[model samples]
Target chain A: MMQKSTIRVLLAGAAIATVLAGCGARDKAPAAQPQVAPSVAHSSGNAGSSAEPQAPQSKPQAPQPKTASVHTYFGDENGTGLVVKQTTITYASDSDKYGAALKALQHPGDSKAVSLFDGFTFKSVKLESGKLYLDLKLDDQARTGSEAEELTLQALQKTLFQFPEVAEIYVTVDGAKVDSLMGHMDLPYPIKRSQ
Target chain B: MKRLWVGAGLLLGMLALPQVAMAAGGATTQLFLNGKPLAAEVPPRIISGNTLVPVRIIAENLGAKVGWDDRTKQVTVTSGATKLVLTIDKPEVAVGDKTEQLEVAPTIVEGNTMLPVRFVAEKLGLKVTWDELTRSVFLYKKSSGTAAADSGANGGTSGAGGSAAAGAGAAGSTGANAGAGTAGGTAAGGASAGVAHAAEPDPDSKPGIVQAIDFTGDRLTIKTNGVTTKPNLFHLSGPERLVLDVPYAVLDEALKAKLNGTVGEIAVQHPLAQKIRFSNYSSDPPTARIIIDLKGRAELVPVEAKQLQPGQFAYDLKLAKYLVVIDAGHGGKDSGAISVTGKMEKTFNLAMATKVSELLRKEPLIEVQMTRSDDTFVELDDRVAFANTRNADLFLSIHGNKYTASSTGTETYYYRDESLDFAKTIHKHLVPATGFADRGVRQEPFRVVKGTTMPGILVEVGYLSNKNDEKKMFDEAFQNQVAASLVAGIKDYLNIQ
Candidate 1:
């Protein structure tokens, strides 16, 4: 068990390193969102550091923590299937990272993609015993068809399930459990990872 | 003003495409008027976030006069002393001398002048309550002071005797008649249907208000007041009868009136059942009983019981033929996984599922159903529920996989233990036809496989991400070979010649 866990940790580190490298090589990102994929530039404290000196200087001379790029799912151009995109997120802790991932759902990587999460305002995100509870305030009149409602939940599920710690997810609107997102398709409370 | 004029044309376009039309309307929203399902050609639909219904149906049922003016493109509804005028594609409705703004304009769908029912019903002194669990809309007349008090008296009596009825135990029928402590609670049954339109917070009041027992096609749907309760099901062998006993429930007045005689027989037409019988069962603990008398040694198999809404439940019973649900995963807006060649996994899945469905249809003993026949976005939950509600014997979800380019093979997945054998049999015939590496039958918690109760399998024909696999997947001849192999596997699993 010890060896298996050690190997798993090594594989995870390698995966993160690969993602960090990819973030560094992606120079064709939109100019307005230049802060996108700043993992390598920020962590190494070199290369792009000359452009933004204060960013590196703000922290002590100690090795700066790297920004991690996570895979975020969003609605495609037609608002049909979910398209995976890499989003760079900075976090002070694990809980902060979970919140950032949820917040990322609201902003799609591309203009053509849609975000079903716009109607929800994230109230609180709590993780206990591998179960993640997300409390959100949903707009009273935000109703959609069956397909849209299902797709929205699927996107939310796919995005959050990427975190290894989140074994299950439960969503509450206005701090109350709702039967469905828009009176279409029943939502399983504490949606299992398998779901 | 110009955009409003396009409503008719837009509606026509939507109707032309059956899938689009289904999506535009909240698929499961049922409308009830005076305690019965409103027999409307078009179901209630949400347009621009507002629930709209045919004004004619509710108006006529409420004993109101409805008039349409062709020249002005306006509808005039006069219910008692209140008069309301609504113009086509207009956002404002004239209620008496006052004008009220509508968030969504009145649109003509299928020649029916659809209006936001809540606004129109309220204006006509009608009460509109929506049940989100069942997506049901209840339209009824407003209650008077005397009516409320009368219903309250019934509730008080029922509440008092609730404990005595509970003590009556499983054989509630015998103990209930003797303990008539409910004091002719039949009045509550008759009046409460009209009085209690929504689930009130009062615990003493009836929670399980059995709204209507609907028998349509091959299904029996029990509409309730959004209270969840499990019904005890048992079979009697003398004449082959199935009994369903629902606890903590009382039949609504409209439904109780349909009971016909002391036995509460409900006349129904079905291949399996000779007739259906219903009764209040008990008043204090509140229970309802439905008995289905089978015909000619017809085996009444309790296939599935689904909660259609929080308060609504449907039971499907099957006899003779085996039902197989063919699901084509992801369509229309949901392209699923995009292939290396830019082809969609949705198209491949639909094509494969359709081919297998056609083969299954030819079999005499096998009845085939497809979750979707064409390009349409069906929710994952909807697909599972659709199969479950129909009580299908087998479920097959077709899809193409997507991963790294190196991952190229055909694989089959099953979540439930019962489905493992089915998946293995299907994989045996399927993997060889793909002419790819055999990944073997594996256990995976895919939503489609996990959600379905029946022995179900999701077959990943080949990886869409791989260039070689993607090329082969697009080949029509290869698809035909896979489809034929799949059908053979199904026949093998079912032990059919």
Candidate 2:
């Protein structure tokens, strides 16, 4: 029994080390000011899946471009530790879908739900083999610990995975693939969507 | 500004590396496999706070022949019942027919295939024993081992009453393990998940009383009503602390009253020490938990008291060497200040900071840890947290300054009054060594310095923005000179010649 407990702790430490190994800082960090809007810097050679038409509402009209709001998770103030919250994020166009999802993570629906990207910016985002890759540059204000690290990754993963097109999310801090998210949780590359 | 530095880049990995730092370190841990003491080729290092040993030593001792594949970077070990395949920097291990997700990956450190000891031991049906005081990992095969069963025995006694380690007539003291009357009165399930376990403690074991707490000389002792069982003791660095959990002891009326007047959410101080908090943290076999918030890195002395009084026994602890935290200013995403010669201030800060560590490490008495060892982004808050948790004796943040062309010299900064002496000591040697105009030492409310509890100094080696100062700061010879001078200043402050 004691050995099992000891193993759990070791696993936790290993989970954390993997994240720390992949975490990197930018050479030139900008100030802590939050970036304005998601830029058109988001690029995609293939955004073919999320282009399906929306089901007609009430009466048949021109096949309206499908739009959806992203759902994200954050630590809650009540009995349960985490609660999933929705934001006014819309993914209607294929070219701008990734940026919209990332924007939701950068600025959460609730102020209480922290923005993981508040002090960071992304150089680019890519999708291949059904996985979305994010190359981010973290700034000085970005907190590093079990809580901040895990919550930030969950917020990003849960939000981006909302799109049927994105089945897994692989995060690279400043362009390096990571083994864990923020040094504790196991970050299996192409982080799969969590229920 | 005098506080300028180049941005520290957080290095990503190849197999795309993410972050650089894993966890903190402590006194070296010794590894012992089976009944005989085993030695690791690389001496087993603490990575991210977990003690990892060379795979070959333990695998061979467990009767396994190991083979390493250079192309695949995989380690395959074949034992009697186990055939294991592990990859470097990957999180999964395949044991026989079962695939298990690994918490930590096996890595090649300095060309040695190092794997986490606990992971290896448990997978092979061996028990891993951790000795906190000596920092030892004792591995004993499960069939003949009694340690696991001994620890589990407490669970049987917890439900009936209080700590019954000795399992005698005093077992009727109202179960502290069942969320009943214990030390802090938070019920039995109040064992915090932070420093210790969250599971229920044994309630039926022979309950022992915590008669007294003794603090004298260089050691602190805990006195109990009977022979204390294997109470676990270990120290954690961040916010430096010590934890002692006596799983078979209950808070009797005498000790409960003392704890009642004390042991709250707010910690009470001991004159010689910081604070000692107590609780009846478990109920299974009944347990008593004590937490000590320390002021520095503490080393436990091997000598424990045989007897304090007629019925009381004592456990002794001691403190160790002075801890020093070194901070390299300006890292990734935050470019502190660009140099007049187009060099990044972050570059010089890291260079000099590492040099200082290289020189200081030669001294046996001083323990040095850098907030960063490479071009990685570490938050300013975390930098202080690293020092604060370690309860460092001194903190030195090294950086080259940036200012108008007219502003060209060395200066030192301090936030608290206690830090003034440190600033003056470093500046006295640094200015002359740099051959720049002396701006002297002054007080400033810098985040890194202001937040840390220990005396801290932020030294501006030279102006990165000034032409002459920039030229000097950029030179490798000058950088080494500055590093040596900083070490000298530290030695002087520590009263070393």
Q: Highest TM-score among the candidates is held by which one?
A: 1
Model 1 TM-score (B-chain only): 0.44
**Residue B79 in candidate 2 has what lDDT?**
67
As a TM-score, model 2 comes out at 0.36
Q: What lDDT would each prediction earn against the true structure?
A: 0.64, 0.57
Q: Supply candidate 2's per-residue lDDT for B231.
A: 52
lDDT of model 1 at position A139: 57
Q: Give residue B453's lDDT in candidate 1 (0 to 100).
A: 76
Candidate 1, B1-497: lDDT as tens digits: 00001111211221222211222243445555433334343456777667888765656555578898855878888987889899888998899999989998888653356878888877776656665544556665534432335433533334334344343343344323322122111110011122222212223445477787777777877777766355555444445666555655777888778754434666788877887877776443345767678774333333344536566667676665678999987776567666777777789889999999988888877889999999998867668767765657899988887644566788787889999999999999998899999877867556678778789988889878789998998898999999989988989998878
Local accuracy of candidate 1 as per-residue lDDT tens digits, A1-195: 676565544434543454445544232122232223222112222322333344434557555334445556666554336666656555555566677777777777456556667657888998898999998876522333233455778878877887777899998877877545543345778799877
Task: Output per-candidate TM-scores for chain A, rounded to 2 decimals.
Answer: 0.68, 0.54
**Per-prediction backbone clash count:** 4, 62
Name the docking class for model 2.
Answer: incorrect
